[model samples]
Target chain A: MQALVIVAHGSHLNPDSSAPTHAHADTIRSTGAFDEVKTGFWKEEPSLREVLRTVESEEVFVIPLFVSEGYFTEQVIPRELRLDGWDVSAWDSDGLSADTATLVAEDTGQTVHYCGPVGTHEAMTDVLVRRAETVTGDPEVGDGFGLAVVGHGTERNENSAKAIEYHAERVRAMDRFEEVQALYMDEEPEVDDVTEYFESEDVVVVPLFIADGFHTQEDIPEDMGLTDDYRTGYDVPSEVDGHRIWYAGAVGTEGLMADVILERAADAGADIESAIATVREATRKTEADGEPGKTDTDREPRETDTDGETQAAGD
Target chain B: MTDVQATAVDVRDEQVDALLKRLGSNDGPIEFDGLSAATDADGYALSTPESGDHRGLSEAEFRAAATEDGVAPYVTNWHYWEETVGHRGRHRRAFLRRAEAADERSVPARYVDLDSGMETEWGEVVVTATLGENGDRRYEIRHADDVGAAEDELDGYDDPLDARQIATDDDRGRYRPLKSAPTLISGWIFENLGGRDAVETLDVLYPASVANWNLEREDELDVTHWRETAERQTGIYDIIEDLPREAVEWVAEACCVDSQCLKRREWQYDEGDDLAADNGAGAFPCREPCSLVVAAARKWTKLEEEETHTYEFELTPSEKEQVEAIVDAVADGRIDEIREADVYEGANRYRTRFLRAKRFDEDGSLSGTPTDPTDEN
Candidate 1:
């Protein structure tokens, strides 16, 4: 049996920060493509380390739901999920390439498959365009609207801006709208300066983000002068500086990502039939022999210090 | 790399002129409006600082004229010392401070009410004039007895209590301390203060003050400093320019963005890259994990700049279970219970299993980091 885990950057302040991640996980679970599909977050419940232990399957697929190959993807996610391309517990596992699809667990024979982030997938470009079109009404119209793909670009790294720029290019190439602009909250070609990239008065700004948190909800709208209300709460087709600005929600939250998740799972070469059989056998065994999902190894650490972050044995 | 310079200007010409004239001569209180000169120290008598002729009034005479008008809590006008340097309505300023102390216990009722009138919101009651935490008169209220106050109010019942017209601390309004005319940065010169480029960079970074101020130029004009002068005077934000660019880069570049996502914002503003780079923890503004570097550290162990060696060993199903127990034990801080833990061949591999189990890649390598500002963390 195998399980799928979707990882996201969750917020401690906004409760809705990880909602889409959880929603997508639930949507995948309903299809039963894998024995289990769990969601883990950095700042919220079910941390990556904790989620890894919940898998009863012999394999697990870890998919990052981020929009780019920046810090979290290059450094944080790999570090958190222990996907640094080496498994010292397994001989010769040290030099495996970072893009390697599979690795056998040294102790449990559990194979872990790492997949690319959902944002980097080729399918995401279309998702971004679709998100924009929702606000613009239709792309087939003769009077097309301008589109701006806004990202939380930074001065510390260039790849952050590049992700949005890449998508903006893809969206631009579609030529469905009069203009396509890639804007950032921090870096150059700022969201506030989106007017420079487009000639049309009716513009659509789609947030190229994984979640509807601060950058998507508060900062961009404020900078772009779309509306005073945060996170698309107010009416769209709102006029700003004589231009009708139509704002769309973050690209990652679209329901279409369910297909992308499955595609990533398939990219990992998960054998659904075998996993299904294994899950059935395990269930039968649990009922027949009373060998529930309990194991001494599943026990949480016993902490000497009561105040330590040591977790409970089971959630 | 050039040093970060300071652009702050010190004493302004108008302020200096005002300071000097007040200290240079006494502006006597006199009767005005075509009134005959009265022997009594009369209230409401209009007077102006008649330059040079003010030299006739003695300090004692000025005080007598001002005191006869009155001292705080009951005073109508405090223009006597208002013209003095830095100290305006000194008695009333002290009075407001005492009234705000919750523990002080002995304040006039009107002053106690005035304190509440300063901050936050209250119902239906109209607030004309209110003080501030600092000594800023925040509003220009028409405090005529029959001005804005309502029928049952203190005086001049018109729009609520028409408080007195005065100064303000409103940033968008005139008279904001930082937005004063001529931009009040100090001008105390410091030789070799990081030179031209440094000061220019400081000018860009510091939100206050401009650059190239010279004391010699001021002294060349035959102006003399009775007290210690400043190297450069500046608004409160001037100090930020003095910090190393990297230390304050996040502040300037920050978008108030919330995410744990890291992006490339490679800034070349490090004109002083010759200095030691900041490999230490940067700012973490996100309450939840932002895409920023610091927030990524919350859960992403790969982002953690640490060293770890990998060890792999095959374990039987039961042996794997034992490793899990040991890992769990160690994680729960129950290591003592695992004293005999290595009974399994994978016992030595427990810590390694912990990382693998925790989701690290095969190599204990956290080296996939793509871009950085200083090439340090």
Candidate 2:
């Protein structure tokens, strides 16, 4: 059985930050398409190192549940999981030789597969559009309405801003609103700057963030000079100077995120038969040099190891 | 009783005579001028006999001062009253009486608009008062516009004492509740991470353990076991468990080995080196890794309980595709960035996908591996 572990950047402060990831993990696990579906966080309990230790699967796929391809996705998760030069030869079940195995190895062989962040999947565009529409009530390309896609952009990673730009471009292509633009909290063409970019008199500001925390509440409003009473009604315009702006809640608030996550899993390698076939082929090649009739591919009988010291079958 | 009465009467005559002389000399209208002169002279403005200030003076004296002497005479000759009461007494009394009747009565309320005053829906009002119940006493208040309007709306009572109480009560009611963000966040950390003691330990040791630095104290010759024990109890592991996953990841990235500030130590194996002889030499190299393990365990346990569950496995290819499409859209930032045409497309896609996934088998029979994912399960 295969296992997928979705790792998230949790918070020591805000429970809402980790809530969506946890919900998505539940959805994946409930489907029961894999042997295991777990979640791990960097800040909260179950530290990255502990997650590697606790993961029992011989072959576990790690998926970063982040919004961008930043430091955590690029450097931190890999380091924590010790993915460098790790080998999985001992855990291989199909009696395959080392040369025939497709598994990558390090000096100290530990087996693990690290996938790209779930945020990098193509399906996230739907979430952004849906959120924008729900907030602005105009999901079509036309005159009068404006869309501002706001992201938590930092100076640390230029690629992080790409997710926002990608979504903005897609939105602009649809031409549903009179205008669609991308903005950030940190980088240039900030949320305030994008306010001027919109062609329409009215704009809907949607935060492409996972939680309704400081950035969404304090920073965004501070930059925009929003008073406490602003954005009380969905249709009513939040007047800044003469321009009317409306705000939607953060993108993470959408309930359909669970579906999105499951869809990502399917897109990654969800076809059970295909995945099994691939593993089998790899196992067979590795086993070609071993004893002819002795294949380790068969599932072990339930009660063979009475001493509770069962050895893993080698491929 | 006779001795007490004689003393009270004498005090009342003396006070009334002085006040009458002050009022007789003042120039303004009787009500306004008398009070103003009395306030200007003695710093002891007179209210109706029912006022709290009335109780401060001898009853006989207050009665005589207000009735027999009358208010107008005091208004006319206010300086004489000031001479009798003392230099600052008149100003103090004026402010106190104004503060007392600010809600119910239209007394000339003394106020100072400060920069840090409150903000109200209506207009702002700033009030500062110096009280002299028996002698000279003072208190200051600066309210926001909303509070000022609220204060203005209060009903005026006939008695000054009742008016004072009413004003005080209104002021208290108008005070905004203290912002609870800090307390709420702290409490959340404490409750989630076991308790205050556990949280305190984590706060202390988190920097040292996560950053791989030794903590130094001013008093100790060397770091002792008790301090170590404290640090261990409050380790980064415990701190992480209290946090949500995203915060954990952010902090770890900011502080751990991958951080910009981290100093990487390269290992060189020499012949006959026992350190290099063991395959597990680098395992648990520092407290940082151990703390990380603890943090990961807590996070894992939490996620296991929150995420994994049983469901039936009966989804059509189309349904699965729809789900996959939605997921892809989210991952690629398409759904999150849907524009005019894409908005409808994204919504339709999400709706179909969500419905299909929500329609798992009624029996709750999951098709994947046998291991129960959730600890509760």
Task: Show model 2 residue runs off by greater than 4 Å.
Answer: A86-111, A136-144, A228-237, A272-315, B1-377
- lDDT value for candidate 1? 0.43
Summarize candidate 2's per-residue lDDT along A1-315 as a digit string, tens digits: 456767776654444555666666655555566776656666543455435433334566666776666556554666555566433332232211111122322311335566555454555666666555444444341367787888766564555577778777887887777788888887778886656777677877777766455566555665765545234312234677667777665666554455445555555555444433333232121223332322122111111112111001000
TM-score of every candidate relative to the true structure: 0.38, 0.38
Score each candidate by Cα lDDT: 0.43, 0.43
Q: How does chain A of candidate 2 score by TM-score against the true chain A?
A: 0.69
Candidate with best DockQ: 2
lDDT of 1 by residue, B1-377 (tens): 11111111122233323323444445443232111111223322213231112223344443333322111221111211133212322222322232233124222232344443432111111123333221122322222222333434432212110110111122233321111112122211111111122222222211111110111212221121101011121222123224333433443243221121111122223423322322222111111112222232222323233445354445556656765775665644355444344644334456546535654434443232223323433
The DockQ score of candidate 1 comes to 0.01
Best by the lDDT measure: 1
DockQ of each candidate, alpha-carbon based? 0.01, 0.02
TM-score of 2: 0.38
Question: Pick by TM-score: which candidate is best?
Answer: 1
